[model samples]
Target: MPLTPIDPRLDPGVSAALAAVAEREVDQVFFVACGGSLSIMHPAKFMLDQHSAALPSDVLNAAEFVARAPKRLTKQSLVVLCSMTGTTKETVAATKFAQSAGALTLVLTTDPASPLAEAGDHAIGFEAPYTTGVPIDAKNSNYARIYQLVLGLAKIFDGSDKLGALMDSLEALQPAIDRAHTHFAPLFADYAPRLAKKDVIYTMASGADYGAAYSFAICVLMEMQWINSHAIHANEFFHGPFEVLDENASFVLFKGLDSTRPLTERAETFLHRFGATENILVLDAAELDLSGIDAGLAGNLVPLIFFDTLWRFAYKIADLRDQEMLEARRYMKKLHDY
Candidate 1:
C-alpha cells in the first residue's frame, strides 16, 4: 500500500507564514533545535547552502544558540525551531531568544499550544501522531515539510519555479521511501544479531547524507540502544580517525548519489581491502530503484530516502538486542537541571 503525501496536509497558514518571510526579504535562516530535531535540520542547511547562496543559513543547538546569541541574527533573519512535543526547554528558550533578537521565527511541532510553538511569531502544527523512541514517521514527515518549506521560500525570493516543479515531481516520495524500507528490511533483520555482539561500531558517510549517518549513530545507536558508535565523514575518514580502523573494526557505511559518492567508494575500498577481520555493512543508495522519481531531482532526494532505510536498520538492531529504545535514556530527562 502507498503512503499518503504528508506535505499536502500542512496547514494553509504555513504558506502565508513562509510567504511573509520571503516578502520581507529574509537574508539569513537559522535551523535551531535540540537533539534529533537539530539533526533533522542538517540536510536543510545543506540544501540551502547548495541552492540558495543568497540566503545564508546555519544549524544551531538550541541551548548553545541561546547562550551565545549571535550578533548577526536580526529582523531579517528567519529561525526555524522544531520540536515534536514543542515543550523542550532549550528549544522553547531558543524560540524566545530568537524572538527577543527580533528574528522572524517559525516553529514546527505536534502541539500548537506548547511553549516553543507559542513563543514563535508563527508556527506550523504537524498534527502527526508521535511514535515511541525514534519517531521515524514524524521525523520523515518533518524532513519533507522542512525541505519543501525552505525551497518554497527560496523559489518565492529567487522568482524561479524550479523548486515548485521539483516538488510536484516528488508527490510520490512517501511511497518511494516506503519501497526502499521494504527492500532493506530483511537485510537489517539478518544483520542485527551479528551486530549485537559488537561493543562499538563506526558509521560513516559524506555530503548531504552525513546527517543520516550522524542521526543513526547518535540518536538511534548511542542514545536509543546504549551502543557506542562514531559517525565519521568519508572525506575526513583518513584524518586522525583512520588510526582506529583495524581488522577487527565494525562499520556501517552509507553511500549516496551525490558528488561525494566517490569519497564513500574510496573509504569502502580501503576498509574492505585492508581491514580483514572488519565487519562491514555498506548501504548504497543506488541499490534502491529510484525509477519512479525524476532523474534531475534524484540526487537531492536519495540522501533523504536513504535515511529512512538507515532508521529501519537501526530499529531492527535495537529490537534484536532486546533493548527498550525509550527506556535506555538515563541522563536525557533523568537529570533535568543541566
Candidate 2:
C-alpha cells in the first residue's frame, strides 16, 4: 500500500467513519488514546456528536481510562479505541475490558500486530507519510492522518460529497506547510524564553481548538516547556480559571474556518476577563478552499489545520533546544510494555 500522509488521509477517513456511524445503530463511542493521537482524536469526536447527534463520544487518556472509565466498556457502548502505535498498554487493557463487558471494539492503528489491534473485533490500518517521534522537530504523520480520516468519516456519515474539494486541496497544501515553517522561525525564537524562563506555562484553547490546545499543552509540559501546562477548554474558561489568565500565563487560541469562529470569538471574550490579550497569541492559519467539502467532511478537518500548526509549532520549539529536550520521551514507553 502506498503510504498516506497524515494530513491528507485524516479528512476523508473521518468523514467516512462518521458516515458509517450514521448508517449504523451505535449508541455511544469511546476513544482511548495517548499523545498526538489522543489530542487529534477529539475534534472528530466533537464533530461526530455535533453532526449525527446519534452518539455521544469520549476521548480519554489510555492510562486513566482503563482504571477509571469502566462505564465505557458496558454492553451498550460502542468502543472506538485509537493509539497510533496500536500498542499502548492502557489502550490494550481497556479494549480487553470493553470486550469483556460485551461491547464491540473497533481499533484504529498504524500496526496490525499491535496489542490494541489484536484485541479489537474490527481493526483498520493507516500509514503516515512522515515520522512520529524520530527527531525533536519532525512532523507527526499519524496526527495528520487522524485528522484526514476523521473528516472523511464525518462526510461519510452525512453521505455528502462536499469533502472532495478539501481532499483535492491537500496536494496544494504542501507549499503552504513549507511556507508556514519559514514564518515560524521567529515566533519559535520569541517563545524560546518561556521554555527556558517561565515559572508556570499554561496553554489554553477555547471552542474547536480545545483538543489541539490540550494536546500541545501536554506535549510542552512533558517534552519541552517542562511545566504543568493545563489545556483549558474555552467553554470552561469563564467558569473559574479565567481569573488566572494574567501576565503569568501564555495563551494560544486555534482558528479554523467553521463553527470554530464562534468558539474563538467567545474565547477572545474570556481572555479579556483575565487581561490575557497582550500575552495571547492566535495561531495563524489561512483558510483553505474547503468549499467542496461535505458537511460530514468539514467537521473532521476543521480542527486538523490548527492541530497540525500547533504540533509544528511545538516541534520547532523542541528543535531550537538541544537533543536533551526530546530525549525524554520515546514513543509509548511503559504503556505498551505488555
Query: Quick one: best TM-score, which candidate?
Result: 1
Full-model lDDT for every candidate: 0.75, 0.59
User: Could you give candidate 1's per-residue lDDT for residues 47-163 as a string of tens digits?
Assistant: 676667578888999999988888889988899999988989899989888988889898888777888878888887664423433334422367666766777665656644445
lDDT of 2 by residue, 9-54 (tens): 4434443444444444555667777776677667667656555443
- Regions of candidate 1 where Cα sits further than 4 Å from its true position: 1-13, 127-140, 276-278
RMSD of 2: 5.8
The candidate maximizing lDDT is 1
Alpha-carbon RMSD, each predicted model: 4.7, 5.8
Q: Cα deviation of 227 in candidate 2 (Å)?
A: 2.3
